[model samples]
Target: MKLPIHPIMEQSFAVIDREIGEHKFTSGEYAIVQRVIHTTADFEFAQLIKFSPGVIETAIAALQNKTPIITDVGMVRQGIANLVAQTFNNPIIVAVEEAPVALPGKTRTETGLLSCWRKFPEAIFVFGNAPTALLAFCEVLKNTSVKPAFAIGAPVGFISVVESKHALAKTSIPQIRVDGRKGGSPVAAAILNALIVLSC
Candidate 1:
């Protein structure tokens, strides 16, 4: 079945294309955006692209007249983390937005988010914080050799639906997402996954 771009998505895509092209990002970076937006929607699609460094690399390269970044954000970041570790030879970073929960083993697991991000300082910096913190991270990233790639602030439960969309909209980042008062890890992931295919 062929899926057309949602009305909102067409508007969003126009914004993305204008920003990316006007900025004159590298061909490779443009390619990454193209691939992620146009990647084949299949069983293997989930494992194919990455979020941070994988895509960020393309963004920086484009700016420098080098390669381009070509990736999008979806719900599968959790699973893709492992795939990125295995398949991606370069460094990568990821930032997650979550609230503080006072639990013994549940709070923040340094090893999981930290250990993975450390693999490629040149590649990654996974963050788990609020939207403000996330944007601050993006500002810091702007000073680096590579530009920031895809970013998602979708949080699950409670009032996160409005919060996530607001957070995402605040940035100039090309976020591929749907508009509605919905929030959940699975829902976010599923929507992102579907958009990855739909945007193509």
Candidate 2:
């Protein structure tokens, strides 16, 4: 299935290409970076975004295999829902929505994310907003033998954002991460949408 690009968006992409000339990213990685820049209109993502070795291929395989997708917030799930439906139609789970209440020491999103992890350890986990959730997920990954198919750590905040990303980076799990505190649902969605396009 081919995705249609509006004329305005096509022009925007052209502008992005002109402005981001001579990049180090591979073709697939560049596609993800371009989409993230398009979504946020921020060229800095080109530098902030980092991918683990072979992660693009691994992510594509997971999507094609119809792995479930767990997002830290509803916004991230909403952002990627349409493209996901058009592509693999993998089950999209919103962590905050799934957990009825926060656990004793955890935030609602963290608790929900943990619950989702227990149910779908091999799912594609995307953290676009809650650093607490990402941190909790990282801890779970440390203790468990089960690992997610892939992870996207792009939570945006000051509190624990950088730490969460660092925790994810330390793990052996394949991942795409934004190194600093400049990421959100839109960037996470753009990365997934780019992967969907690449899978096609």
Candidate 3:
């Protein structure tokens, strides 16, 4: 089947390539990033053309049922949180490398990294961290009963991005990603936005 590339995906690929070209990343890493973008875009296109509204409605409904949305990065999680709140009334939980604390004159404290997982029994977890952290998350999922429909840990950096993709390669879950050296909120947000759009 011929796959259509979303405009956003194309743009993301270009962005990643341009960024990688100027960075110290290895050629293999660059190729891997390209592969990830191609695969993710192709998959999303297939869903949009094949399932169309069904998939989107299901995801929306899942959120309406108060399914937990888990994420590692604060910024990306913030975007996901907003999208979830806007699209559904589900509870959202963010998993971070550190936990937040509420202490006088203290900006933040890591209450506990793993503690966040307790908020949701079975929720979709989105991660954007280094290879080690990504693998750790995946391992935890493997050792547990959490089954995710859509998940991603594409870090968008040299070793970390490569590591994130590698860790996910072992799983069969659908994922969204962008190619670049440094993945930030924009990349994560754009991915979620695309999912929402295509899901419709």
Candidate 4:
């Protein structure tokens, strides 16, 4: 059966265009912003979402080249739209969880990220749930020669979400993410999906 939600979602873009005018975002930037707002219904992201100068261009190039994508959570992996996979043919890597986390005093997210850090240096890292994952990725990036194509650090929660995103923004790596605790799996997925649409 056809889902009625599709048309309603289509209409929301018109509403968004009307609601937000004369914005500073470039075309690709605006697309990502609009998609994030559509996914989360959060208007405040107009001010909160941040990106580097060439983030959209760099990310699009990376996607087109089939850059590997790594996620902190399964939700983010699952949320990646089919169009992105089919178009980019990218590998989606989730943080490890096959066995009990071995790192001392580390959350599963942290240890899992640690395990996969070496395997993926130039990946597009998406952290949609665990702040520790974002922090760990940043740390790993710093300690190694591996650089990411784009880092989407949108982990949600009060603990380290704000700080982690801030750190990611300051890094030399190109990044696309939001500040505060208003991000999640859907937001990360939305950013990736928007990038894919723009690239295609």
Using lDDT, rank the candidates from best to worst.
2, 4, 3, 1
| Clashes by residue pair, model 3 | 99-110, 99-111, 156-181, 157-181
- For each candidate, what is the lDDT? 0.36, 0.93, 0.50, 0.83
lDDT of 1 by residue, 64-100 (tens): 3311111112234552333333332232223322223
Query: What is the overall TM-score of model 2 with all chains considered together?
Result: 0.98
Superposed Cα deviation of residue 162, candidate 1 (Å): 0.9
lDDT per residue for candidate 3 within 77-139, as digits (tens), equals 666665555555455565553455533432121222245555553565555544444555555
**Winner on TM-score (1 vs 4):** 4
Error of 3 at 58 (Å): 7.0
TM-score of each: 0.34, 0.98, 0.55, 0.92
Highest-TM-score candidate? 2
Q: Which of 1 and 4 is ahead in lDDT?
A: 4
Model 1, residue 159: distance off in Å is 2.4
- Least lDDT summed over 10 consecutive residues: which range in candidate 4? 1-10
Candidate 3 has a TM-score of 0.55
Off by over 4 Å in 1: 1-77, 82-86, 89-147, 187-200
Ranking by TM-score: 2, 4, 3, 1
Off by over 4 Å in 2: none
Global fold similarity of model 4 (TM-score)? 0.92
lDDT of 1 at 154: 36
Residue 126: error of model 3 in Å?
1.6
Window of ten residues with lowest summed lDDT in model 2: 1-10
Positional deviation of residue 54's Cα in model 1 after best superposition, in angstroms: 16
